[model samples]
Target: MFSFFESQRLLFYYLGFLAFALAVLTKGIAGLFFGPVILIYALINKKLIGLLKNPHTYISFLGMAVLVLGYYFGREALNPGYLEIVSFNELGGRFEENLGSKKFGYWYHLEGFKNYRFAPWLLLALLALPLAYYSKDDKLRKLTTLSTLAVLVHFFVISSSSTKQPWYDLPMYPFLAMLASIPLWILYSALQKVNLYSFALSGKIIAFLLLVVVFRAPYQEVWDATYKPSEPPWNYETMGSEHFLFNVLYGKDNLDKAKVLHLGNNDHLRFYKKVLAQKGIEVELIEPENLQSGDVIVTCQAEIQSLLNENYRLELLNDSSVYRKYRILSANRKSPIDHR
Candidate 1:
């Protein structure tokens, strides 16, 4: 959008406003920062007055407002308090309070660049900024200025927020990558000059090698996360229990009649319950006092021990480290309970 505005592409500028509206819908208020970013660019370029006088700017603003407000208002009408929830929980709370246990200082995201979160690219991007800003090409300098402004504005806004999450830094990566590309292209061009015993490698060969070196770690990381089978513990007990439930629900003998009960509350259990529901399995929450014969229970080791101490006989089905599955056989009422 900034590029289009810079190049005086009026049609694309209007379309960019609509695109910005979609971005806001997809990412909540984080997308609103783009407006301030562009305004800052206009001010820096001394085009603020011209931009304000442009009637298409007002028309574009109206279009964007209609698209964004239509969805928000429609949702609020259907679900009362939706706007309040979004404003308070999603936006306002993040700015005013620490919402999670894993809180970090303001420099958290900035430190991530050194800690392999952005890595290699972020360092190179920082190095390229000065060169990009002072480039002989007018277009390059303009773009560098705009991108630098965006990165600075976004960084400050997110870093100043009281609540922080790793994924919240996602939007900044694209602009950083744009900055990084200048140095990468320069390196690729330099690589093209390499000679081995009077033999010159083609630009294509250099580019291919450069790409392989650049992408290898990220590619391997993606492959390991998605396709590779995870080892125990890292597989997470909740995930293992999800697999166990899948097998039981679709077993050859068809234990479809078995009552599946989740015996305790945990973050993982709550999250995977939704995952299990998506696969057509329903897990009911059951208290220890409600234990009944033939009920298939899913719980942690401590809860299982508590059940055993209460004289409830259970046949262990599967144990996934922290979590376990068991079938209640009987409760021996006459037996003395072990307080220990």
Candidate 2:
């Protein structure tokens, strides 16, 4: 039983489930890369350790795991596409092309760009700092430096051409560890050089500062935003999709004034539309046969949700959850709302 849990295949399979949860809860990218990238890194590192005779092989594995997991959960994500880098909204819409072309989405229309916030800058800073701080103790300073630079260069170059996301930056975490390991590692090369007992003050101070920095404002936001719903119509606190959609579809003065569509698939679409009807919002649930040419679609991240191409454009939207309402749905916003 213990071995099964520890087995790479089993571990990755479980983590892949987590990725699915993540994909549904927030963005699909987390679930997409979480297991795959970590498994790949473990395999690569394990191979390297096997080629050499070192007493610290197990210790190195532990350290690498810690580093990778830390970066995976702690550091900023390198998400792909404009949604990670911008804000977009879809009011009472399931899907719509040219509805708001500038809105951040996965597919590129003839439209140019939309919101470009500080996410990119923040991600770069995250990759450079603490990793370097932690790696300061390593002995392979130069090798680590060159190697890290190479990795960073590749990451930046590859990402530069394509769209960007917070998770996309994850590929660079390993490299940053390489750079960060240089300083402290040289000092701790052996117990005799300075001894682990020495420089207790600096370690505590750095650790405290790191804890503060790493667990600062973003951590709070992540905790809050992670568990809480980001928008209204969908309770950030509860399963609000049904309530939200119903209200949007038939909530007195809302349906008539709004153009909406469920981008991917929500089996509950009919259920929610029924709720809307009960609330006096008259709406027509649709299939491809019923689709209008210029219908507006309200899209959210729907993991593995299937839909007919003729029914909706399959537009994916990110979250711009304002208050209790899920305001906008970018292609990247996996809100667990689409239960197709």
Measured by lDDT, the strongest candidate is: 1
Q: For model 1, what is the C-alpha lDDT against the true structure?
A: 0.72
- Quote model 1's TM-score: 0.74
Model 2 misplaced regions, further than 4 Å: 1-143, 156-170, 173-206, 231-243, 246-260, 263-284, 287-340
Model 2 per-residue lDDT tens digits across residues 20-91 = 454533542333333333333434446434323434434544554564454445433554443422223221
Q: Model 1 over residues 1-340: C-alpha lDDT tens digits?
A: 7767667889788878888898899988888876788898888888889889999889999999999889999999999999998898667897888778378898998898657777767778887777776667677777777778888898898888888887777788888888887777767776777775666666557777997998898899899988974545754433544554545546522334444344344455556456667777665655555666777776544544575646777887766554566777888765444333
Residue 88 in candidate 2 has what lDDT? 32
Residue 187 error for model 2, in Å? 12
User: Any runs in candidate 1 off by more than 4 Å, and if so which?
Assistant: 99-102, 193-201, 229-238, 246-289, 293-296, 300-318, 321-323, 326-340
Clash counts for the predictions, in order: 0, 60
Best by TM-score: 1
Q: How far off is residue 205 in model 1, in Å?
A: 1.8
